[model samples]
Target chain A: MENQVTRVVFYVSDGTAITAEAIGHAVLSQYPVSLTQHILPFVETVERAREIRTRIDEIYARSGRRPLVFYSIVAAEVREQIVASQGFCQDILAALVSPLQEELGVPPQSTLRRTHGLTKHNFERYDARIAAIDYTLAHDDGMSLRQLDQAEAILLGVSRCGKTPTSLYLAMQFGIRAVNYPFIADDMDVLALPPGLRPHHDKLFGLTIDPERLAVIREERRSGSLYASLRQCRLEITEVEALYRRHGIPHLNTTNHSVEEISTKVIEMLGLERRMF
Target chain B: MENQVTRVVFYVSDGTAITAEAIGHAVLSQYPVSLTQHILPFVETVERAREIRTRIDEIYARSGRRPLVFYSIVAAEVREQIVASQGFCQDILAALVSPLQEELGVPPQSTLRRTHGLTKHNFERYDARIAAIDYTLAHDDGMSLRQLDQAEAILLGVSRCGKTPTSLYLAMQFGIRAVNYPFIADDMDVLALPPGLRPHHDKLFGLTIDPERLAVIREERRSGSLYASLRQCRLEITEVEALYRRHGIPHLNTTNHSVEEISTKVIEMLGLERRMF
Candidate 1:
């Protein structure tokens, strides 16, 4: 920790500050500097802004280096306080907004716009997202097969192979109704698509993982059990991969991917319309 | 849609394109223009990049205006194809990265860095996230109070008051072990903290909603029923709010907030350390 150059960075916003944090992380990832990060969200009031400004200034005084502040604040008074601090303040949204405003020839709306807030304009979409989540929860782990028609995608995988998280991400992030079913040890003897899932084959997506990784994940849940054995994991994966290939089901190896990547790839492979929340 | 200035915007990337789309949406929200938006993810191949470039060029030729393109690609060859198109291209991360490079006195690494990818460096953190999700799912809706010691926060709310989604978001986005318990009509007669939850009073947070909104949301699930009645909603909310006040539990009205906003506020209110995934 003492070896590299450490920089203090803050992501500040009047709203959730998710956008600022995301952009800041992406920008910082490019450089080799280590970061001591803080996120200050919902900085709407002037008092809070002044406190944050003081914090930024104090960090500068203590470190003898200017802190980097990436912020998206709508109010001028609050934003000015952060700008007045002894830090390099970068407006996360302003750089792109100015060009877009010029292109559209429309003055930017000065109203406090909540990028991640619920408004009347997006209430329906928001409701749909909730519905997707509900549908997903009800159908998780093959809980129900009655509503297969409503599912945008059905994920098939062994336990802990990234099906549940990917399904939930698809529903939560993109408002897509996702169903995930697990292929347990009992199914290894006769590895075939369940009769109930046969009709929805087009929506089926498989997730397989490296046996070594799967064994490690399972061992965490049930330590020193046969279920967590490497031999079992390898056997299950071999059978599952053979089943997928025989059925011509498009699948992904989830050994090295995150839930975000798996969900995005699932949506792309299935040609599902990506709904932005 | 025709009355307003309509612009075609593309968020192109070699990865999930989530960051690009997020930044693009935040920037474009300030303007009053209608958008025909497209997200092109995983444009890793030159062939795919060329196709996207042709698509952007065709849109420009048809509209007689340069389409707006916000992209983040690590590959020079693929990025050049998008840049060569007749669109107002904006490098989403480059604008900030260049300045940070000068600040840190470190040259940026030219390797392909996947912002949302799982790697050995983050595998333990990633495992913790999955464990959080598993804990949350097991403890959702008062499924079990056996592991209250492991919970970072316990959400208390009336039915349909936005506890479940908020809890899931906290677990998924911040890797917080959140447990949500719903107050049902059966418990309204003697409204008090459950015996199991009394030990974790410090971890308890309340979520309330407007009666009208609760009724509307409930009606979507069960139309023309007592469960969806406005009177029932009002009674439940009144009792829940009184209970929250009696217990000195901090609460928020989730009537006008999105899941993201509510989750962020919960973490802020509880002073929980925000973990970035």
Candidate 2:
């Protein structure tokens, strides 16, 4: 809100909004809580499309400063529509993906990753492989923890910092073995990693989000319960973070970040080898 | 390849393998495909836990005596590693998803719905507003489209039989606002769903799949290109089901399906009735 001047990075893709979301999500990471954010929908229809322009002007007029508008797509009409707005700056989405344009792109890549007819077969092999691994792991009698030894990373977080999906994401994208351990009361509250898990500290990566956000997530899973209570969420988060602090564990707060951002941070933190596009 | 075994159904929590892949894949789903399939992962696990063991055991050996394993948290070491030889199984990894249980069955209730703390001035305003709208449609922009207006039931068919992901399966699960579209062409051909795609029918659903299994998808994408060459995949899949025939539209094949699945399918197809949950 400083200078009544807003600097916002909008990710506009000439392709599907999915790409836009990824890029937008990535960009959000570059800035912490300091930046104000607004993500408007796919700019379709002249009316729905024109709203951004007016809003920018309104913001500009109200603040007496130019508004920063990041345009995510490459549609000429969409671009034109966005540009017509007075005092609004337009930033192209794709270009912002990376300095190495060709490197960070998917095909049908130019327009969008044409995701039509993605056969179940293609999905099966990869998915089944993952599920198969999941199956084998699920079936493994804990007599052996050796399989997880080679894991590139392990995620530690209270019950819902999105560790499972993030772990699977790491496995899927980087082909790295990732394991997540939930912070249940028996363990998280006691400020002690489960005895079975304490040995893996060297590979552990912690994920923490705003307790408020955690409460929101819990509410979605089970509303109106002590489990989902914000009061409970705050207490747990504070307890966990304090334990993490005492244990010298480095953690990332996932509030206001996408899974990609969180994963990227984990990869960066773990110094994992980059994933092939 | 086993004696008297023509088909196999694997119930997985992720659902990627059994439904997206096993339903109609190459290495897994082929002429050998037989039997009515049920890949309900935790449903059986929960049922089994609730003394539904007979039901689960029956399902496992249901492939006319060959046995179909309904694996889940049933076998996780988290629960002291229940042991059952020659019956349904489980392991640790798959147990991760058990936390999501209360959200699905018995009428869509999300565990994340009730927690408070997000009531910070900004959080509550936005959260409450979005909570009032359709969760599916409100959570994200509902950015991708498959003829929302004319869509009867969107078919979310990835290549091969990802159709189950988009059509029958989704419809059966959520109940409304379904649409599906297919992606064709491979890494080369520049054709995806035609321009001005006001699907002659109602809302449009989409299907995509894993790329590794999309030899036919490669064919559809490039039609005889080196990548799509049956010689490459060494299978008659391409000739067996042309792209349009399988997915019901000329689409832009996206071999790797990730974001599109979560946002597009979750929002457009399922159309979660309310946002709070």
Residue B40 of candidate 2: its Cα lDDT? 34
lDDT of 2 by residue, B133-251 (tens): 22222111223463355334444343343442233222222223344444433522443444434444233444343334556545645676765654544333343235445445433
Clashes of each: 0, 77
- Model 1 residue A18 CA deviation (Å) reads 0.9
Q: Alpha-carbon interface RMSD of model 2?
A: 17.2
Q: What TM value does model 2 have?
A: 0.39
Writing each residue's lDDT as its tens digit, candidate 2 over A119-177 gives 34455444543432242223222223555666667777787676754565465444456
Q: Per-residue alpha-carbon lDDT of model 1 for A156-207, expressed as tens digits? A: 9999999988899999999999999999999999998999999989999999
